[model samples]
Target: MGRSWQGRGRGRDMEYDKGGDNIGGASLKKIETEKGVIARFVIGRSANKGDSMDKSIDAENSQTDDFIILDNVVEAPEEASKKVKLFFAYAADRWDAQFYAKANDNIYVNMDALGSTLAAHLGKPRAYIGCMKSGEVFSEPNQKWYEPEWWKFGDKKAYFRHAYGEMYVITNALARFVSINRRVGSKKMGFQERTPLMVAAMYGSFGVLTYIISTGRSDVNRVSSDEKVTAHHCAVSACFVSIVEVIKILLDASTL
Candidate 1:
């Protein structure tokens, strides 16, 4: 495992307290394996802005010499054998190019600290799955807006139930079949429309849980939308299934 420190801003100097804790310094730790590496970073309050910690940890793996960061954000159908850097961003800020430029010297942030924090949550003999949820803003159809329903009995219940069941089945089956991975996603939607960020944040947890359960070695059904069936976002069911499959492959390879 490799460790590093990172922080936010240019002018602020990180100060260590009597407990030897840096106010802004965030610590990073990378778990290296022959198949891939999972790098997690710990950040203090100063660095917890948006999804900053998440992006930074992803950057470590994406920025590495051996791995290839996909140009397309759209999920792909086929799985690749290349090593992956699964980043868990605990901080609230979005990690942009500017953050990467100052990754090496920010004293207030210790990346290792962040990694340790996550490790505690992950527990020993760690396993996980990667389930992703599109932000509510992106999922919203402008023309199809309606007031939130208290009881979605007719079509909504059926839809949510199916989604929930599928998710449960996939996660549970994958966990039973595989080993040593993480899974995550959001099971519910937030009430507020403007605060779509909360919904997006849920995806991280969902993805971790999905990954842990799938473990990169499970049978996944292809997503499709027919006349009788409709997905949350028109044609995203297949995309979701495919992503789970990809994680399954990655986890399987890692175990090998």
Candidate 2:
């Protein structure tokens, strides 16, 4: 069986039936159907910037219908999309919702306003309602969001008009779609970042690091491109549960 998703704004919810994966772009008629990705508006922490990030900080950070908070998600990003993916699974499984969103632990949402916003989309099938953003496909190796398979595309700037990640709604239809075809989205985007494996090891995000290792996309012993350190060295430098779990996992993977 095939899976399908709907897009809000100007796009239509194209129905699929075990036929093809739509990865965006006209030349690539099929893209992988990602599962467990429903829809969410999230709270985020402000972090470093990629040079391509737009400079209109004032317009982006302002409160609007798209943001569940006072800032656009792209500006104040959330924790990794993995965490939000899990949130989508849990919320969709346990409750019946027209749309779902995620906020930081410290943020509060107005239920009344959210309910009203969702009301407009009740009839929209598989509707994902969020402020859509089209970002550059980072292709350079060892950089953040570097799509290892960038050569598949004719041009990065061209595909920007197609599929994007930041959707913010989920209905029964969307949840069922996720249940059927969900898997990890980015195969290697963060795997070779400013040394993400090392960052995860040092920051005590053992869970994130473990997933990276499990993918067979990372080399535990390889030194980072940016920090010039191995995962083991970063694990040793960290002070927390990471010193135990991260180190052991790294050692085990290194031997394997």
Candidate whose TM-score is highest:
2
lDDT of 1: 0.24
Model 1 RMSD in angstroms: 19.3
Residue-wise lDDT of candidate 2 within 1-256, one digit each (tens)?
1112222122222322222422113211221222212121223223444332222222332421111221222322233443344345444555455454433221112223334444544555454433223456667898876777677756653233321232233444655555344454421221111111100000111111100111111112212222332343234334323323432343234321
Best by lDDT: 2
Model 2: residue 217 alpha-carbon error in angstroms: 25
Global CA lDDT of candidate 2, please?
A: 0.31
Give each model's whole-structure lDDT.
Answer: 0.24, 0.31
What is the overall TM-score of model 2 with all chains considered together? 0.35
What's each prediction's TM-score? Answer: 0.21, 0.35
Q: What digit string (tens of lDDT, one per residue) describes model 1 on residues 1-256? A: 2222122123343222211321111211122221112222222111233355435534544543221223221122121111111111211122211011011111112223322222333321222333333322222335353325424435343223211212211122222222123232222221111100100111122122101111111111111122322333324445544645654553454331
Model 2: worst 10 consecutive residues (lDDT sum): 198-207
Off by over 4 Å in 1: 1-67, 71-110, 126-154, 157-256
Positional deviation of residue 119's Cα in model 2 after best superposition, in angstroms:
2.4
